[model samples]
Target: MKKLLLLLVAVIGLSSCNKDSQEPRPVVPEGEGQPISVSFTGEVEDDSPRALEGTVNGSPAGKLLSFRGKGDVYGWVYVVDKDGEFAKGYKKLKVSEDGRSLSYEGTVPTTRSGGGTIDNATAKVSIYIGLDASGVFTNKGFKSIENVGHASGSSLGDDFAILKSENNALTYVSRSISGKYHEYKASNGKLSFSMAGSLILIRFRNEFQSPSHKVLWRKISGVLIKVADGAPLTRDPAIIDQMRVMNLHIDKIKIAVKDGNTQLTGTNEPSSGFIDNSTRYPNGYFFNLAKTVSIPTNTNRGVNSPFDNRESVIAFYTPISKRVDGRAGELAAFSFRLQNEAHYKEERFEDGLFSMASHRSVTFRSELEEGRVHRALLNITYQHVEGGGKN
Candidate 1:
C-alpha cells in the first residue's frame, strides 16, 4: 500500500512539473487593429423659393469624404498616419445610393513611422459634395491640392466648383456643397457628419412691353452672366462702336495661370480675350449662369410663372475671394450682367447704342453664412430706345 501511494504521489508531482514548464500563450488587446466605421449624415441648409419651405430641391447625392488623397472628388488615400504629412492619406468614401448617407471602413496608419494600424484619435477627414472628384472645375480651387493630376499630383488640394455636372449624376442638380473643411475624431470607432451648401440664389424675370400696352413677364433664352467689377459697361468710348462689346460672352471668358485653366488643355495660351482680358472692365471670369431656358410665347404668359412665379434661379457658388482688401474687394465691386444674345447675332445692334439685355446687372455681393442661401431678386425690363439711342 505505501509503495503504491508513493508511486501515485510521484506521478502527480511529475504531471504538475510538466504543466508548469510549458510556455504561456500571448494575449491581445480589445478593439486593436480594426477598421474604423465612418458614416455620413445631414441635410443642406438653403433658402427655399417658398420662405417657409427651405430649398425646393432635396439633399444632394454622392458626397465625397476624402482623407488625404488628391483634390478630386474621388482618389486614392496615400497614408493613414496623422503625424506625417503623407502618413494618413486620401480615400474616397462610398456615398449611399440615395445620397443621404456616405460610409467608409478602413484601417489608417497609426504612426508616422510607416506601419499601418487603426487609430481613433489620429484620423482626420474632409468632405465634398456637389463638386467634381475629378480635377476639372478649374477656378474654384480644385487644382490647389498637391500633385492633383501630375505624376506626383494628388487631386486632393483643389477647390471644387459648386456646379453639379453630369459627372455627379448621383447628386441633385440644384444641391451644392459649402466649401468648408471638416475633421474626424471618433472615440467609438464610428464617424458621422452633416454638410450644408452655400449658394447665391438669383431669381430673375424678363418683363417686356406687349402690344396690349401692358408690361408682361416672359422666359427668354441664353441666360448667362459675366463676373465683372461694378455695373455693366454702358458704351466704351475707347473702342469703336462696331468693336464695342457690352455683355461678356462665354467664349470671351478669360482664364489666367493662377486661375487654374492653363493646365486644363495643357496649353498656356490666354483663356479668352474680348471681355475676359479687356482692360476696360474688371470682368474676372465668365460662366454660363443657367441652362438655356426656352422662350415662352406671348400667349403662354399666364397669371402664374414657372416654379412659383420664379422664372429661373441661378445658384452660384461664389468663387469670389473673402479678403476685403484683396480679390474680395475686386469681387465686391463685381456684378453679374446678362448677356445680350441678340448683340452676338450675325446682325449688329440697330445702331451704335448698346441694347440693355435683361435690363442691367445688380450687385453680386452678399454675406456668406454657412448653410445660408443668399437671395437676390433682379427684374429685367427690355429698355429699347427706338432707333437705337446713339451716343
Candidate 2:
C-alpha cells in the first residue's frame, strides 16, 4: 500500500508540472507600427528684474497665451529613423483647459520589409508650433523653416516669426525624441517648449518732481528699434552672414492708447500684426497701430506722489539670437519719435527723438534671452536749466 501511494503522488506532481508548462504566455505584437504618446509642457522664462503683473489685453504678461480657444494653433510633426525621414504630417495639438500642457498622439515606424523588425532602430521626432502648414513646410513635404517671415523677394526676415495680436502673442516651442523602438513605448516623457523669442516692454515714467521743471510730455508718433550688429534673429545661414555687420530695423511703430493707458485696444489692425518687409528699409520690418500713444505727465503731489496715476507702456515682440560660444545676446537700441517736435525743443530736449543709448546716466544693459521679458524704463525727467527758477 505504501509503494502504491508514492507512485500516485509522483504522477500528480508530473501532471501539475506539465499543465503549468502548457499554459499560454502573453505576447506583444512586433514587426508593425507602434503607437506613441507625446506630451508637451510650455514654459516662459521671465528674465526681467521684476515680474510682470496684470495682463496685456486678456493675455497674461510673460506667459504663453491660451492655445485652446484659438482654432489656428497647429503644427507639423516629423518622424525619422535610420532609413531617414519616413513620416511627416500635420498635427493639431490638443491644449489642456488651463493651457499649460499639450498632447499629441501618433504612430512610430518600427518595421522593415518582409515582416522583419528593424534592429537598433532609432526614432527622431520634431514639432514646431505657431506656423502655418504652408509656411513651415515646402511642397516636397520637407521643412522650410529658413524662409518663414521672409518677404516675397527680400532676403531678410525672421526665420521663425512669432505671431502677435492685440488679444495675445503667439509663441512656439519645439521638442525631439530618440531611442530604440521598444523604448518609445515606455517614453511618455515631457517635451518642454519655451517661448521661441523675447518680449520687449518699454515703460514710460514721468519723474519730474519740481513744478518749474515740468514739461509737457508729447504724444509718441513712432518708435524705432535697431538690433545690434551680428545678432542672429533668423536661422538662415546666408542671412546670418549678411546680418553680421548690419543692424535689423523695426521702424514705423504706431502706438495705440486708450484713455491714459497704453493698452492694445484696437480692433481694425491685423490680428497677427502685419509685417512690412519693404526694401526701403533693408533687414527691417514694421507694424501699424490704430492710434498715437501719448505719454503721461508727472503729478506734482508733494514728495509722496512723483509719477502719474496712469501707466504708459509699449510692448514689442522680437526674435532673440541664441547664445554662441558662451556669449550673451545683445539688447536692441530704441529711439522714440514725438508727435510734436517743437514741444521737445521747447523743453530743451535734443530733437523729438529720445534715443535710449544717448542717455549716459541711465545705464541699462540687460543680456537678451529667448522667451524672457526685457523691461526698459524710460524716465521723462526734466533737466534743470541753470537760469530757470524752481520753487
**Top TM-score hit:** 2
> Across residues 103-131, which tens digit of lDDT does each residue of candidate 2 receive?
56544333334434322235445555544
TM-score of 1: 0.42
Assess each prediction's global lDDT (C-alpha) against the native. 0.27, 0.31
lDDT by residue (311-361, candidate 1, tens digit) is 323433332213122444343222344344443211113233233434334
Show where candidate 2 strays beyond 4 Å: 1-51, 58-64, 68-72, 81-86, 107-121, 136-188, 206-290, 299-310, 323-331, 347-367, 379-391
Whole-structure CA lDDT of model 1: 0.27
